[model samples]
Target: MKQHHVWTWPIAGYLFLGGLGAGMSIVCAVADLFFGKGELLGLAPLGALLCLCLGSGLLIFELGRPLQFWRVFSTQRAVLTFGAWMVILLVVFDALYFSFFSGWFPWSAAAGARAVVAVIALLLGLGVLLYTGIELSSMKARVLWNTPALPVLFALSGILTGVAGDYLVCGLWPYGGPAADAEALAGILRPLMAGLAVATVVSLLLYVLMMYTSSNPTGRTAATRWLRGSYALPFWLGAVAAGLVLPLLLLILGGMAAALGALLFIVGGVFLRFLTVYSDDRRELAGERERLLKLPHGDEPFLKSNWG
Candidate 1:
């Protein structure tokens, strides 16, 4: 079978970074709004900002004409354009929220203003997270990506990765902040990480199973590749074992094991993006394979000879 290379590593990187950053912002906002731990988890939003910026760079790099990226915003109707706006708005809000945490302004001390910023950041963050999945699922020609299950799975994975990132930075980093606050935050994140891990695993399994059993042969082929074909190793080892299961087990064990698990989860998140992106095979039309098979091979003598 011919391989599809339209979207590759750069796109995958954008997906991973975008989802992770958005996830981080969502977690931080929630902690701040309801739990009063937003200040304690300040590093998350900063990290989120860095992630979004890096993700946006990767996105631009993936474009044929990187300088023409502004064209994405020229039309307000396309999903990509909407996503671009989401990222921009997310960056703006997340930066403002981070500024408050960083104590850049005296007004940052105001709880009311901080809460409002957090709320906007949180909404925009969720929009970014959902956009990542919607972006792929919107591509109808790619049977493997044209499913509602995809957005749900991606959203779940995004949140799980975000929690893992938070646990690593706020919970594990020695210089993250006050030792007491770090310990407290770690305690809160531990169980949350485990729960998210379990949920992600379930969501992933359902997504793959749905694809494997889908009516579309192309979708099934993609799922088979992940399950037991060429992509199986990465799917099983990188995403399932290392990313979800190992992390869950380590989180249960507590101490340094949980930290390692958190890091593994992030790695797994990256693998997930690559696997999904690469598996996006377009649905084959009737006789498409036969038609291609009849085409002259590059090495054929007739083709090798110059027509002129």
Candidate 2:
């Protein structure tokens, strides 16, 4: 086994992106159901797909060996990973959604099927977020990653980031202002973006609590690094100040303020992922070192052999 540690960047960025994608997807889905459909949500539907596509591509990029990578998903898990069912479903969802926008389907189709689709999407989205969370929590080497709060934290971060992604789309395209049929998206941009702001605040509060309240030293120390140490600038300034705060302000004060806020949110979210991925990887390595050090060794072995 390699002594020291340096994980791939894809693991870091993609995990954060996956969680964010799931979170926002669900939020938009739910909001669309309860408060009526947000056409801006149409913009977000593709985030999970994009995140998954990019994430998978990044893993391939890191590996540079498609056959070896293909083999991992080719086993029993292939059905789950590369199965035609999931791909087909996502494609259908993507297609119908696009068709609605392109006038391929009647407006009646979007309004009619949206409620049911949102519910299903919300459940699946949460599942995706949870899977990312469980992966982190299950890593024995990274004691800091093995916390109860990981899934929720990841999911929340994903949601915040996902919203940022959607706003980015709106900012660049300006919804209906563009030649396309995104005019429907204009109405929901404000509220969908607002929901993203809400998710960010909620995620930040939860993270603060998760850090300080950890029962073990590994968990606490890891959180400390993220909240205060090496990762502090991105965590505080980028994640909180720019990502969360600025977006909230735009939400409260619309127009160019919201556009500016959206830009900040996307940049901030991207930077925040770096902080989280690096911090988590460090925590894992540190935890392993601490444990190995505690093992009986040299003269200490004899004395520590039997418990009194």
Candidate 3:
């Protein structure tokens, strides 16, 4: 079979930015709604709302036509179903985006709307993870993506990548409220970093475990792009060493070490996306082509390649 590489850069950006927006939105929601942290007042949840909206917008437009995106909600079923949840999230995200950009936020009445949307966005933000999980799970053709663990893996990857994206944005975040205080921001950042690092490791283990349990060629297929020399350098030295191993050790240390660890965690998360999409076997894609051109789905007989 001919092995080939396909780039998923735009979708990668969508996945990365969407996850980050959703993650940040959830964090802000938890901070604002439950703990009653007023520091979340201005741009905190707003930023998350905008980012998610922007990312989701990109995704809708990222498709063949932006209008076709509405096909997700044109259903006759009840609204609480998975499709409903998706549609709801899209609407809620859109509202948040429109309201903020239109300068509706500072008004006294906007507070109530913000409160409601924040809670709903939090729930849907979590759904973002499941949405991604279902995306891969629904695709039966790509066996590697067919595992029951795929949804969970995608969820963790989303959260991990999202948090990492948040940290990377720290370079741009202007100081204010909790973020203004260096020590306090460091404190908040450390725990988040540690949590994400732990999550990333767990995700890796689950992936391997899923593969180990599978006897089918579908489950056992390899995406060697990550294991090869060209990709291996950044993936291993940068993503693994700098992102996981080094940050983990520093997290063990404390102080500036913890902060540094957070940076590495973000770096690691970004590359994890790179590795996942690039290393794709897509379940022996040539086989799919053959099935399209030669054999039927259940047919076993096949023609030999001319190269052989």
Regions of model 3 farther than 4 Å from truth: 1-7, 38-42, 57-62, 65-73, 76-113, 163-182, 185-189, 223-235, 250-260, 279-308
Q: How close is candidate 1 to the true structure, as a TM-score?
A: 0.92
* lDDT digits (tens) for residues 176-263 of candidate 3: 4444553444356567766766776777656745664566564554523334545667666766777677888887677666666766
| TM-scores of all predicted structures | 0.92, 0.68, 0.69
lDDT of 2 by residue, 1-308 (tens): 22333445776766665665665566567646775544545556665667656765665666657657656544464323532233334434543443443344556355667666666667666666677666666665575566666666666666666666665554232124343434344446667667756766676657755766777666677677767877677777888887778777876676567667766766666665566555553344446777777765576566777753
Quote model 3's TM-score.
Answer: 0.69
Clashing pairs in 1: none
Against the unseen true structure, what C-alpha lDDT does each candidate score? 0.87, 0.60, 0.58
Residue range with the least summed lDDT across 10 consecutive positions in model 2: 170-179
Q: What range of 10 consecutive residues in model 3 has the weakest lDDT sum?
A: 299-308
Candidates ranked, most accurate by TM-score first = 1, 3, 2
The TM-score obtained by model 2 is 0.68
